[model samples]
Target: MELILKTPIGLEKIAADRLIEMDREISLSVKPHGLEGLIVVERCSDKQALVNYILKNVPEVESLVNVEVETEANLKSIVDAARKVSRGKISEKESFAVRTVRRGRHDFKSIDVNVAAGAAVQEETGAYVNLDHPDKIVQIEIIHDRAGISVTNGFRWKKMSPDKKPALNFFNKISIVQMPYLGSLEGAKEVGARIGRAVQAYEVRELVIAPNKPVDAYELNKFIDGVIEGIESRFRIQCKSYDRKVEKVRVSVQDLYQLVRDRSGEPMIVFEPEGIQLIEAATKLRKIFEEADRVNYLFGSREGIPKGVYRVASMVIDLAPGITLPTELAAPTALASTYTVISMIEQNIEDN
Candidate 1:
């Protein structure tokens, strides 16, 4: 099997070196080409295994794509490659889009490839064209005269092997904290400091904040930007925020759910407290989290979660018994609990 490894532009050799070291027995060949972060790997015994190994061991590798066809770069060749890969790969009921990355100057533009390949795939599979959120992605990489085609679904291409799983699963973790904007801007900044500490402690990368009532977008962004800056002072955890103007907790929660679904093409495992399941046992929570592709933890502000917000939750977990903590405390508490559960899960996996 053949595959493409995407790395930083100048770091292609680093990734290729690691692959060469790992492919001793498989006799794999790595060719760095296009000078555009593309490394082609050919003659592999197990492509999936190598991908898993690279993802776990090689930090420079950004993504991996299993190449279906590598042919001359042109509109007809790209259309034919898209058609061939979409035959059994993309279903008629699924929605698909064509994504083209052109490295060298050519007669055709990238949008031209996307349009032609998208039309061909739609005609061949009867699948609708969805550019925003596609069920299947037909990726075409054109470097000068050569082009590689592959069909994919999600952002994560490498799947970790069971035995080589890491302790902290950062890719699958998401945290949503409700901003306590009911108070003055100073009070909000204080609360932001606490939220920043929580995010840093938990090593969260994606954060979604819901502003309280009477808070506008400008104020919310200003407040949350302060919190993110505070987190950056001590520990470096790159975070992306999903800022919404909704005051209701349910609206923010639903927005986050939709955002995750749109980007990942799968439902996230949402956990919110409804005073039902206790968050005392890490083992039980770990088992539940292991089943999904990712986890989303939701916390409310001073007003607490809305009445019907629990309906969207996959599991309602009670953090504090018979008492509701404030947003500042609740955010950190839930994040710490999740980190502990994931740690225990990883420890158990390592021990076994």
Candidate 2:
């Protein structure tokens, strides 16, 4: 079996060298010059064993594609190869889709290959097409004059991280609830209650409150503790303190700018009505968050974020366009919108 191992551009040689050093049984060759991101491996003693080893040991390798056929890169050649692979692997009762990726200039576009190859696969296997979710995937990769075809039987190849934590459920996310002091004690508590409800509704993991002038750290912490207690008592969920217990409400008191600066390594998104629209911002945020190890969202109070605080912000989102909302309303709106985008992206990742 021939497999295509994809690595970041300019790292193909390093990945190829590592594969050769680790597994002497497999014959590996870096794809010709100009095809800088791919290494072709053939003559593997065990295909699955090599895949597992690469995924576990090679951090440079991004993903692996099982190559069904390595032939000339052309419309006819691609379609014929895809049909042959799909016929053997895809059952007549299953639904399949053709996905083509091109790395070099070609006479035909990727969509052209997809349409022609998809038609050929359908005709050969008598299978219907399901673009969103398919039982089988016919993947065609064209790099200059060479092409690799594969029929994936619902098996996905992902690089494995030994130190990676288990995937998080809805409840496991580490979300921050930023409650800025709104001048009056009654006002702060009232806004805090609304923010607290948002936290409970979204199942946030952490709560951080900023002590604006006149509101000391002790007072802010006590106020947040009370707000959390109220939320628990109201919902009967039994929230735990920062020490960790049943409801699990970990609260902290810190300056908003200082908090953002401290967590600079994590992806940060601030919600401001003057910023970009939420929908477009959410798309970009999803990509950034996916690549980041941690994520934090910042919401402003009536006074708005402290001057120069936005320097640490990676993105500024306008959840409500052309209108300004009070801190209480904006806080929950930002949380709900951000959570919705994250959930949507997570679902897309799972589906694909």
Candidate 3:
């Protein structure tokens, strides 16, 4: 399960650092999915303490939106419910019928009932139906001989993953830095240094800098280099730095496919065989992040995903115009510095 942390207006680096430190103090672990996006933190335990911890620590939080929780029972129920809801038949009754499906935990909340009214009647159809998309959803509750029905006029839930949404729409005006050679750590230090310098120079603290490969033996190296060289080479600040080991490694599409027998189980790709090389280049980003051993920490997006409710400080950078990412992918902000790089400082919600 994941919790989202949202900071729509903006935040600073110290604020972000404080939030992250506070999250740890609250016993919450956060993951950074992207900049200018929500920070997603995993709920390690099934107990409600995770939510309580976040609510207790995060003060500027707006709301906590639990995207979805996948458990053995939930997986089974989701599969069964989806099949049942999608395959069921919709019938016209004596003017009205309301149906409700419980989702998430029973103790927290369940899906409200969807009701339809009118004098239409269909003799061939049954009561079983699919309410995936509906115009009106009504909530009904019965207790102690008293019944409550909430009539929500129009509310639509988004059931698709963030990747499935139109990328351009979701990432509008955001600058993306794509490092296709993230498979190794050779140049990670340089890349991290440049990225940090760019971010700091640009005055934006939040950033999305993926290594060129899924696992960079050099990701920490590059971060260390960036922190050290960034101060002397890029900025005039004097600072000490070193690499922190990553427990897990990130993977590229090709590496992922090579490592896994079932590529279909992972995210679906639409490119043809001729575009395989391009796809490989597009998905090559390492997922290793260990905080630095210095006063300032340079977190790796490929490794250390951000936690929830924390504010991120991003330095803005513009990918050169006409520059193409590996496999012909293009950064949305390639032409301008409109996009802001982000790093999370708190845990309030998970990235959707």
Candidate 4:
């Protein structure tokens, strides 16, 4: 008949008062015996109604937990209580974990309780332990003299952890080879600026302006100026936003054909209509990205990349089968596609 609620340190009295006024059947104490930020309901008529009211109306409280079974604060007692609560609720086919949060000082650490209880639950239920992505979680909330044990479903939304391979780690190895978008000087500058921002958002290693053929000299100069401007503006924001050191993307210029011949050792990927479907090349692309130290992504301006260059390239990817993306959309899409398939590949590798 006890429910524990958590609030800001000084607001525990206010939260307890509100709860007391709702139902006279409950007797409660705010910050029981000088512990801060806790409201302990010694007796209550309805636990479900109180939980619903707090969630709908109470803004002062930060967290709330319903105590299923109250046992003496000791390792053996805690393990037996958890086993009783976890009976037919969890199956052996599902993965599970034990999470302990201890509030008061004791002879044993929180990890000790977790290990003892976890082993008991595993033996009783015959379920496997998956700490990172568990299907169910046995919650242990331990106070100074008493412990609360409950079994809840595990949260499965967290995509990145120390054990999981992050897709962002692979972005720094790519060099974007973009052709000069020539025509009007003003239009070229605008296109170049957008592409610059898109590529630098991921903090890619390099952005190479590669003109496969002769283009307007004035238009090229304006485009180059805009690229530099866009990079600095975005880099400044990144430096302020991120806690770690931020690196500006390197800008370089090399003719598309010569650059391919020079960096023949690296993997070169071209985005064009004549190439194979993305579904078909995804596995091969994942292998190339995993093994190579550097990857080159070639994108066209107004005209597509020359057909001759496709032969020497490692893979030609038609990202969208029937549709051609705009110049600005193309760079970001290429990066997104690369990250999506590679993440799936790494997850599969770990799973198998």
Candidate 5:
């Protein structure tokens, strides 16, 4: 196979139909050999043209792999195939990794092929092995006795790799102190749940419910209950989907004024209309976020923060001047803006 097209499962037929319509000379198989979600290009008048067409025209195709070698799916054959394709493709200055995907029964497991083929490729070409962030990837697609092998530039989307301290990681360092929305029990609960999900979406260092004045006990309880429910549901999905250990967002209640007092030494940012715009504070905020042990952010609900608290805050920010955000949007907007500013800071550092 010159190229293998991957589509969402059950969309293989649509991918094939589009390919045939693009060029009558191109020959391929949909779901080749009973495999699902795969189309193999057997022959094409112009391989490059077909690849370009597939990329631009085929919306259903997820990715297209250009196969360099088609060989028997034995360990020895696989190793030989990998070594043959990788001869001068990689160098010692670059790193490569062998990724094997097996779709049928075989005596040797996928790891066995990775080890044998990786060692073989490494022995033949003096390239380094960096599985986490390889410069090149030797892809192995095995289907029972038949296997297709290819070399490709690795995907560069693993922003959370340990070697990288990505901007998103800073979310862990932020502490969001938001005043709970207090009104009808239903409205309070609904707003609380939205705020809770927003907080846990980042899994921030801490989420503080800061009430400025007396609130109805039933309303507060309902809001807290909804917050708990929101945290639980989102945390469940994160636990199942996240690769690392997911920490459920911590919930705490604090009086608005007291919280400002207690976190006086740390960097505290209050969001309010009277405060400086986010753009103006970005430079200062960058330093605070990067240096502080925990950066506290205060978002008001029904009533704005006590003007007194702004004086004690390290920096007061108006996320959006003139336009007031809805109750649920306040914290999320803060999170997104912080993420953007820090990313800009990192970019500046890199550019320098």
Candidate 6:
């Protein structure tokens, strides 16, 4: 039976092994419970076969923990499904909450009246607009003459720790540059130089600056100059404005196949394509986040991911030149290998 075990970062290998062994083990002495089951993940292939094997051999095994066992390749769909099941909104404060409403459907005309009444009764301005911690997200499902009104907070809330957090500020920079609302070119340059120095201190290969809004072309140029002057050899800085427009990213599965097939080439193109793909996927994922409720299955077209399976398949493909992969896709690849199970998982998540 094959199982793709999912774990948080910084998990120990020994614990992972124990979890894997719980499915099946050759030696009963290893377990205090004297339980034994044997399953070899020879390759990261065939999810159904693995599921059937586990269910047939272990009748008590209703579901596997940590591992996402699905028949389809589209993980984005899975996320969307789960999200629908756990519908809620994320606040600017980085918190998730659920809403419920008693009414079936609300009319804007009536809603305005209610808002005005609420403001008048509450003796507060903008009380209607300030729908913080809304009592409910009113949902109305009308069927014939009968209607179903649901006030739902589907998913439970848990505080995500800061350590497990992904980078929030998408603008990848060594440091932040602060200037007055209308600062001078020198100020921009100084900010860029500080960022460059910070990037050098951190030993990063590249530093990027993303202005919140478009800047004067000359001022932007001066900022780049300061960034270039501050960094040492092998470090460079780039400045660009944040793109508000949504963009579509394309990747040839064949091109990725060939690149992973050849990892030792000069100017190692491994990082570039993967980074671009990830960025594009991230952007798309962000869009889906807006319509998270109605999103049924987030499958990419042929130009992108066909299903969750495509990204998973990419994970199995040889990432390093002339290298072998482990039975457990979660296992680490060769030290020299640029590909990793975690990397593939993250790619799938971002693509989703």
| Top TM-score prediction, candidate number | 5
What is model 2's C-alpha RMSD? 18.1
Model 1: CA > 4 A from native: 25-36, 42-49, 155-352
In candidate 1, residue 216 scores what lDDT? 55
Clashes of each: 0, 2, 58, 0, 0, 11
| Worst 10 contiguous positions by lDDT, candidate 1 | 242-251
Q: Report residue 49 deviation for candidate 1 (angstroms).
A: 4.3
Q: Estimate each model's TM-score.
A: 0.46, 0.48, 0.22, 0.58, 0.88, 0.19
Note the Cα lDDT for every prediction shown.
0.67, 0.72, 0.32, 0.85, 0.88, 0.31
Which digits, one per residue and each the tens of the lDDT, describe model 4 over residues 1-352? 2777889989997887788788888888678657898887778889889888888888888867677888988888998998888778679999899989888877888999889888888888999999978889988888787888878788744546556564456889899999888889898888888888887888888999999978778999989988888888888898998767878899998898999899998899999988888878888888887798889999987898888889888999999989988887888899998788768776788889
Q: Is candidate 1 or candidate 3 better by lDDT?
A: 1
Candidates sorted on lDDT, descending: 5, 4, 2, 1, 3, 6
- Candidate 5 per-residue C-alpha lDDT over 1-352 given as tens digits, one digit per residue, 9 for 90 to 100: 7898889999998889898898898888778779899888989988899889988888898887888999998999999999999988888788999999898899999999999999998998899899988989999998778889999997755647665565446888899998889989999999999988988888898899989888899999999998988899899999988778888889999888888878779988888888888889988888887688898988888887788887788988888899898988999889988788878777789989
lDDT of 1 by residue, 1-352 (tens): 3787788878877887788788865543344343667777767767788888987999898887788898888889889988998899888999988889887778899999999888899999999997766788999987677888999993433344434444345533554645444456676777776776666655554566654345555556556765676566535333333122211111122343344445453223333455554435566667756675556666666666554545655556777666767667776676666666667677779889
Clashing pairs in 5: none
Candidate 2: segments with Cα more than 4 A from true spot: 25-27, 42-48, 155-352
Runs off by more than 4 Å, candidate 3:
1-128, 141-147, 157-352
- Model 4 TM-score is 0.58
Report the number of backbone clashes for model 6.
11
Residue 14 in candidate 4, Cα distance off native in Å: 26
Clashes of 1: 0
Over 4 Å off, model 6 = 1-136, 154-244, 248-352
lDDT of 4: 0.85
Q: What lDDT does candidate 6 reach at residue 23? A: 45
